[model samples]
Target: MPRRLIIDLMRASCDVPFVSLARTLNIRPLLEARGAAASPPGFAAVFVKAFALVARDEPTLRTLYVKWPWPAFYELPRNIAMVATARVEDGEPCVLPQRVGDPDRLTLAEVDAIIRWGKEAPADQVPAFRKMLLTTRLPWPLRRLAWWVGLSFGRQRANWFGNFAVTGVSAYGGGELHALSPGPYILSFDVAKPDGTIGAMIRWDHRVTDAALIARTFARLEEVLNGEIAAEIRASRASEPKPVRAIGA
Candidate 1:
């Protein structure tokens, strides 16, 4: 069925104890610099790298809780982003995650290229889609069993599903109050207001952390966006070739 994969994904997401924390961020500086870039990167790419940078310094954001093999926390060595991307399957629109590992270590252009690949490439060509499709085509009982085994094992879970997700409906002109994912952390953001503030929410597995840490993470996200992310945009603009002057003005 076209919807079977999404159904299984939701089923697994339901098992996690997710909690959300929302904040209004002022990122006018980054937004302005991005608007001025010769070729601006997508907001999804911007948010992905910004969050990964923050997670790089905060171990809690990169930690996950493992159920089977005894309940315990699993902390990844680097940030793996599972970014939700839209695709059409058999005349039906479906969303699949594009995994970008160690995004914090990559440039904004590199991250954008990977996200664009997930969007434009055929489903079979994308590793996440290939894996999900193959599993979805399996018999119902076996499909469910695969999800259980993958989710129960900490290392396998991280490799297959990733540790954090970045998703939003803002491009559709609205914010997502809550987005579901199988990762330990999920970040959703809305369009900016006239005052240049945007509503951002971070829904995380409470089993791994609490509100206080998320609150602090938000502050760091703002800083990274304005500091590192914004700098990248400006740098890109500066690196663009200057226009040739006319013989006579």
Candidate 2:
């Protein structure tokens, strides 16, 4: 087959139903309710933590589909990763801490430490620093290549990789939302409102996960945010001892 023709064929075969499914399910009310009760940490950390927890709890969210010889196939595993662009020192574009696997266990201080170090590191060393900070397995070259391929194919063929992609728009305030091209995972969270309320909008890839499942997940997240999880976070923070300094010695 001709190269263009092959690409067209693949594109045509790509799943598109996920977009429709995502549109039908709304996540605003659920997230707003949760935000009203408990405070989620800073945007970067909260998203990193939430993605880890959600992916761990919902294995289906971590699945991906790749072409096979006999027949096309889907593979499931705990292989989800979170990517975000961070602003370092004014307007510079620096990628900070692309954490892989479960980040839920990481304390707020730990997350801050990683981000702080990433920002302070020299520009040339940034990539290496991020890789070391995030994953122990994947080499920098492979990770970069994989991300590039994923972005290229994901934009062309929606169902090629994992089930979802979450984007944090908190830095942009409450007005804008991010959308992933041709994938089931589309999510955005607003800045905390004066009343400590915010909207969590998820535009899913309908082909992979159904609207009902997404809605249920959003509802569950709200429950976690409002219930014991919030309390636990508060207690955990409260237990930490405050630093005391002796008077001028």
Candidate 3:
């Protein structure tokens, strides 16, 4: 007899989002130059930094349609970063959203480290890891309740889900256009092409902003990723100690 699949809270919560859109970006130069650049922090870190810069420049998109207490929109001052990752928890694989605070001020390396550590280290050491764990551990009914509450209010929304998200797929080679996301904006990119280019898409909230603003943000994101982020990665890589072979001792 076939086994019955046990439903998990994580899988259930993902279905709560009401709406999402799709966009794409080709970042060949940025990808090609990443390894050649000093201290490249990988695509995820660079992407998070790029999003932070763009969000800083254009804060209007940060506003959220909150429907709690009274209908009101809330604008967050700084971005709290979150990257969606599949984590092994208690012998089962679960998708957990890792948090990165004050991403705007963090360099590519710092952001990269936070994400790397989150992936490699114990869940207890990671910030907000427990919250996700607890949420999933909640009684099935409560899990749905919490998600509905979080997704409904503006202030509560930012507290649960960050201002922006980056779901990095550069390491794995494939092209996917849209990613289902909860934040106001998210970046989903494909693996860099052999020629050193990438395809990125932004799925934004149409409730607060339109396609024009998102298009512009996507443009600025590319500029910052290729310019400032690329430079920093290159500089960092230059400072690393090079491996040396001992002359036939």
Candidate 4:
């Protein structure tokens, strides 16, 4: 038998409530080979950007619910994204947080690049990851205090955790319909079929919004992925280089 060293759970320990939801979009006909020589953004970036863009019109998903001191909902201006990224740490595979602010305005290529840099860079060099490391290094009790203060009061929550989070399960080769997150909106992207159909799952804090808003988000997501986003990706083909796969890609 081997003795194991137990570690404190950092972000996972936060007591946030979320309502699980899922939407299946039929993107089959959208990918009918237009002879695109360039590679498109990874599924994760596509979903993240799509959500941010959709949020511009809806605005409901952009609101966060803060409890403690005084219960309230806060609306954020920029669509900051907290993407779950896998990186190498201490010669082992570890998942860290990679934040992309203003993802709504950034092109798909740019968003893809930032996420790639987070995955490729060392944990100490990446600011988001460095902060995560520092917070987790604290004793569990202190860590809880910090999370409580940062997440429940002022603009620290959006600054620290971003407006929303994204995680993917399809890279593991299964079409998952849910992933855990502790914020207003966390999206889980499933596998894409050759026909272009993909599964999208959302976990949202219903205190600020509801299932109706998420349903609209799903519709807008499919719209951008197959419409405007698709056009942008096609345009990138003229100067496209090698593909940059996201973490777990």
Candidate whose TM-score is highest:
1
Q: Which stretches of candidate 1 lie over 4 Å from their true place?
A: none
Task: Please give the TM-score that candidate 2 achieves against the real structure.
Answer: 0.60
lDDT of 4 by residue, 130-215 (tens): 77678767777887787677777638888877778888867789577555555678888778777567777888876787788788
Better of 2 and 4 by lDDT: 4
Model 4 pairs in collision? none
lDDT: worst 10-residue window of model 3: 1-10
Using TM-score as the measure, name the better of candidate 3 and candidate 4.
4
C-alpha TM-scores of all predictions: 0.96, 0.60, 0.82, 0.86
Q: Model-by-model lDDT, in order?
A: 0.89, 0.48, 0.70, 0.74
Q: Evaluated with lDDT, which candidate comes out highest?
A: 1
TM-score, predicted candidate 3 vs. hidden true structure: 0.82
Score candidate 1 by lDDT: 0.89
Separately for all candidates shown, the number of backbone clashes (residues 3 or more apart, or on different chains) is: 0, 6, 12, 0
98: Cα error in model 1, Å: 0.8
Worst 10 residues of 4 by lDDT: 1-10
User: Which rank order by lDDT, best down to worst?
Assistant: 1, 4, 3, 2
Question: lDDT tens digits, residues 1-249, model 3?
Answer: 000011342343354343343445555566656767655676777788888888887777567666678766689887877786656767776556778888879877788888888787888777667676666667768877887687778767887777877885556565674655566777777776666566777776666777788778878877887787766766777788888978985
